[model samples]
Target: MPVLILGLVLFLGVHSLRIFADGWRSRQRARLGELRWKGLYALVSLVGFALICWGFGLARQHAVLLYVPPLALRHANALFTLIAFVLVAAAYVPRNHLKAAFGHPMLLGVMVWAFGHLLATGMLHDVLLFGAFLLWAVALFVASRRRDRREGTRYPAGTLRGSALTLVIGVVAWAVFARWLHLWLIGMSPMG
Candidate 1:
C-alpha cells in the first residue's frame, strides 16, 4: 500500500505539473532543452510506472474486497473501455471531429478508462489506482480545456477519411488489447 501510494504520487504528480504548475514546468522544460527534458520526463514516468506495477502486485497478495461489482457493470466496463480507446485515438488521428470537439481527447479517454475500471472492480488497490487516475485525468482535462479557451485555440476540421480511419484504428486496437493483451498482461479478461 505504501509503495502503491508512493508510485501514484510520483506518477500523478509529474503528470499534474501542466495542470497545477504550468509556469514552473515550462521554465524547467526551457532550461533543460527539449531532448533533455523529455528524456528526464520519460525516465521518471517509467520508474513511476514500474513502481506502480510492483506495488500493485505486492498489494494483491492480500486482496481486500470492498464490494463485488455486479456482472452487468463488468460488461458495461467493456463498452466504456471501447469508447475510451476511440477517444484516445482521436488525440492522434488527424482532423477528427472528436479531437476538434474535445481538444484533449487523451485525457478524456483516461478519465473514462479509469472510471470504467472503478465501476467494474472493487478492491482496495484497484480503487486506489483507478480513483487516483480518474481524479487526475478529470483535473487535467478541465485545466487543459480552460487553457485552450484562454488561448483561443482552434482544432482542425474533420474529414470523413480521417474520421473513419480513427474509428478503425481505435476499434482494432481495442479489440486486440481487450481480447489478448488484457488477459496476457493483467491476468484478467474483460470480455468474459
Candidate 2:
C-alpha cells in the first residue's frame, strides 16, 4: 500500500506540473532540453508505474474488502468503459467530434475510466487508486480547458467519417480487452 501510494504521488505529481506550475515546468524543460526532460520523465513514470502495479498486486493478495458492490454495477462499468475508450481514441484521432467538443478528450476518458472502476470495485486499494485518478482527471480537465482558453486554442471542426473511425477503433479495442487482454493482464474480465 505504501508503494502504491508513493507511486501515485510520483506519477500523478509529475503529471500535475502543467496544471499547477506551467512556468516551472517550462523552465526545467528549457534547462534540460526536450530529449533529456522527456527521458527523465519517462524513467520516473516507468518506475512509478512498476511500483503501482507491484503494490496493487500485493494489496489485492491481502484482499481488504470494503462495501460489496451490486452485480449490476459491473455491467454499468462495462458500459462506462466503452464510452471511456471512445473518448480516449478521440484524443489521438484528428478531427474527432469528441475531441472537438471536449477539447481534452484524454482527461475526460480518464475520468470515465476511473469512475467506472470506482463503481465496480469495493476495496480499499481500489478506492484509493481510482479515487485519486478521478480527482486528478477532474483537476486536469479544468486546468487544460483554462489553458486552452488562455491560449485561444481552436480545435478543427470534426467530420462524421473521423467520428465513425474513432468509434470503430474504440469498439474493437474495447472488445479485444474485454474478451481477452483484460482478463489476461488485469486478472479480471470486463465482459464477465
Candidate 3:
C-alpha cells in the first residue's frame, strides 16, 4: 500500500504539474529545452509506472477487501470500458467528432475507466488506485477545458469517415483487450 501510494504520488504529481503550475512548467521547459524536458518527463513517468505495476501486484497478494461489488456492476464495467476505449481512440484519431466535441477525450476516458473500475472492484488497493485516477482525471479535464477556453482553441471539423474509423478502431482495440490482454496482463477477464 505504501509503495502503491508512492507510485501514485510520483505519477499523478508529475501529471498534475500542468494543471497546478502551468507558469512554472513553461519556465522549466524554457530553461531545460523541450527535448530535455520531455526526456526527463518520460523517464520519470516510466519509473512511476513500473512502481505502480509492481506495487499493485504486491498489494493484490495481500488482498484487503473493502466491499464486494455486485455482479451486475462488474458486468456494467464492460460497457463503461468500451466507451472509454472509444474516447481514448478519439484522442488519437485525426478529425474525429468525439475529439472536436470533447477537447480532452483522453482525460475523460481515464475518468470513465477509473470510475468503472471503482464500481467493479472494492478492495482497498483498488479504491486507492482508481479513486486517485478518478480525482486526477476530473481535475485535469476541468483545468484543460479552462485553458482551451482561455486560449480560444478551435478543433478541426470532423469527417464522417474519420469518425467511423475511430469508432471501428476503438471497438476492435476494446475487443482485443477485453478478450485477451486483460486476462493475460491483469489476470482478470471482463467477460467473466
lDDT of 3 by residue, 1-192 (tens): 888888898899899999888899999999999999999998888888888888999999998999999999999999999999999999999999999999989999999999999999999999999999999999999999998999999998888988999899989999999999999999988878
Cα lDDT of candidate 1 equals 0.92
**After superposition, which runs of candidate 3 have C-alpha atoms over 4 Å from their true positions?**
none
Task: Assess candidate 2 and give its TM-score to the true structure.
Answer: 0.97
Whole-model lDDT per candidate? 0.92, 0.91, 0.93
Estimated TM-score for each candidate: 0.97, 0.97, 0.98
Over the stretch 1-192, how does candidate 2's per-residue lDDT look in tens digits? 898999998889889999888899899999999999999989988988888888888888887889899999988999999999999999999998998898999899899999999999999999999999999999999989998999999998888988999899999988888899989988987776
The C-alpha RMSD of each candidate to the native structure, in angstroms, is: 0.9, 0.8, 0.8
Error of 3 at 117 (Å): 0.6
- In the range 4-123, model 1's lDDT, one tens digit per residue, is 888888889888998888899999999999999999988888888888988998889888999899999999999999999999999999999899889999999999999999999999
Error of 2 at 146 (Å): 0.7
